[model samples]
Target: MYANTPRTTATRHRDRMSYDRDLVHSVLDEAWVCHLSFVVDGEPRVLPTLHVRIGDVLYVHGSTGSRPLRSAQPDGIKVSVAVTLLDGLVLARSQFHHSANYRSVVAHGTATVVTDPAEKSAVLTAIAEKIAVGRAADTRPPTPKELAQTSVLALPLVEVAAKMRTGGVSDDPEDYALPHWAGVLPLRVVAGDPEPDKGVEGVPDYLRAVIGVTG
Candidate 1:
């Protein structure tokens, strides 16, 4: 649990909410893209990328020719990864009271390359499946040359914090009488109809099971 882990300067308090590890992992699992931040050449860089969570390990991929991937080789990689989901827009009578309702997770950890071929292949499959469940089995596996041209890194979720704000708008007591409505406009992510690519003979049962639908 996050409460069991010591809160340092980096992992200290979140003003709005208290979170356990389960809440944090749940938020991460629901999100597809994460922003990865690290220091390179004494300058900070943040990259938005797709990632997959397998247990406590988070996997990120890049081309073998990437500069940041090359820089991660010699020195240990210190990174901060974050994901945020906006749930609603909070409208209040006072401008100061305006805010957003969101759930977010921040994790600080060290990243290292996955060197084993078998493990690398499995991680790649997990990544593909995450994009669209069961897509990995339908597509051709990566060739030897393609495997050699890709880079994968694993970052353990050692220190993490989740913060969230929900419910209706909060307005100042004095401003509540002002001529403005206050409430939350909810939002959500819904999947659209699945479209097959050209030359596809038919969708398989494994894919149907993965998507929880049948045509």
Candidate 2:
């Protein structure tokens, strides 16, 4: 079955949209950042931030005073979240036919601040691991003061939609005879060389694993 109402129907490109649980979860899991849209005082704002998914919940952390997080508190607040991973560029012979090959996920839902310190801390660990495999254990835990200023908000994995496009250029039949060349340009994210700090003894094993480096 499909997800909630808002995600069930696609006004455009219905064939490219899906509500499959596995597809939605995979998109969210593979994405490192998301654009969250929330309204405050009759105005809408979107902010890009890091997030991590644990089971059916997605957690985003930031300062307690942040506008978006503050608005999403005990009372709960509805927001829109979008995550996209651009895989390639479809270069058609004609400009109008140029398109992008990408996987995107969108969802509308309520988000709320996580009040339980223990749960919040645990969420932080999961988020850290998402950034770098074993990053959570390598750094100092959040202190009381730090935790006080921080806010970890959660959004349920409901009302979600995943849309994706993949293939070569979709050129017009007439364009096939044209001299212009057309093809797909594939792209992907990659890790950069490790930059060790002066005080650090050496690169940690976790860093090595993430960067494909060995000491």
What would the per-residue lDDT of candidate 1 be over residues 88-202, giving only the tens digit for each residue?
A: 8998888888888888887777888777778788888887786567779778998777777667778887777778888897787888788888888887675434577898666
Question: Runs in model 1 with CA error above 4 Å?
Answer: 3-19, 64-66, 201-215
TM-score of 1: 0.82
Candidate 1: the clashing residue pairs are: none
Residue 105 displacement in candidate 1 (angstroms): 1.1
lDDT score, candidate 1: 0.74
Candidate 2 C-alpha error for residue 209, in Å: 2.3
lDDT scores of the candidates, listed in order: 0.74, 0.80
Alpha carbon lDDT of residue 83, candidate 1? Answer: 87
lDDT of 2: 0.80
